[model samples]
Target: MNSANLNIRTDKDVKEQAEQIFAELGLNMTIAINLFLRTAIRKRGIPFDLLLDAPNETTIAAMEEGKRLLNDPAAPKFSDMEDLKAALDS
Candidate 1:
């Protein structure tokens, strides 16, 4: 099959990072872009989910609680796995 050039402009850092990742996975930019395009055509949409990973309020509260517990002087500390198990059982 005859091949054609596909030109796309992206940030220098983004291009470098993506190229590095593709190289590690035994792919180059052309192969990676073609794979993406072919997959998108086959799936009729983006092949991967595009979701914001922002933490929810409940998750944020839990993380804050964990930080507080870590800093608390009275928080119980276990020296070993057996001690932790014994504390949990009590």
Candidate 2:
């Protein structure tokens, strides 16, 4: 099969970040881009969702609080469902 060079203009940091992500997924940029192109052709559209529904402020705060509680030694731990319910009731 014949191959072609595809040149693209992208921000250095963005390219580096993309490379890191692709590497983590066991793919190089060429394979990742080719997969994307083939998938796009098969789907007749972009292969992934473009609309990103990021966590709202309330959700972010709750997640941060959950993490803090997880790391806290003083955070209560219940041995079972009844114990958990008892703690909640107290």
Candidate 3:
């Protein structure tokens, strides 16, 4: 694959932090960046989610409720894929 130069300017503190992380992962900054670019090209999305944090309490509660409902023994069961598909079509 062809490649070109990508120049970015970051604060020294940020660069130092990134270098430490890359070192821990056994990769230099260049390799890490190349992997990121390759993955972004392949997936057409950012290499990582980059979320600041997980869902907050309200969102977590709603997700847990949904999971409970799905796994409840008393929940109705569809016979097969076709039945589920039919239900969706209806």
Candidate 4:
């Protein structure tokens, strides 16, 4: 069987990070890429789950609210468990 060259363009940092991870997993870049391709072929799609890792709208709003409360001088603060429980029960 004959092998052909496959060239891919990627960011330098991305390549370096991938190389480091592959090295830790006992694979070179070439072998790691080949494994990915083979798995894709066998699975009829990409071998891993693709996800959007950014915070959702609700999470973003909650984070913003938390930041606002953290900066507000009038925000409630609990010094101990009893104080926290009393505040919650009110």
What residue pairs are clashing in model 4?
none
TM-score of each: 0.58, 0.54, 0.52, 0.58
| Model 4 ranges with Cα > 4 A deviation | 54-90
What digit string (tens of lDDT, one per residue) describes model 1 on residues 1-90? 999998899999999999999999999999999999999999999999999899999999999998998899899878899999999999
Top candidate on lDDT is: 1
Q: Which residue window of length 10 is worst by lDDT in model 4? A: 70-79
As a TM-score, model 3 comes out at 0.52
lDDT tens digits by residue: candidate 4, 1-90: 689999999999999999999999999999999999999999999899998899999999999999999899999877899998998999
Misplaced by over 4 Å in model 1 are 57-90
How many pairs of residues in model 3 come into backbone collision?
A: 0
Query: Judged by lDDT relative to the true structure, which candidate is superior, 1 or 4?
Result: 1
Pairs that collide, model 3:
none
Pairs in steric clash, model 1: none
Q: Could you give candidate 2's per-residue lDDT for residues 1-90 as a string of tens digits?
A: 899999999999999999999999999999999999999999999998898889999999999999998899999876799999988899
lDDT, candidate 4, equals 0.95
RMSD in angstroms, all models?
Answer: 10.5, 12.7, 14.3, 9.8
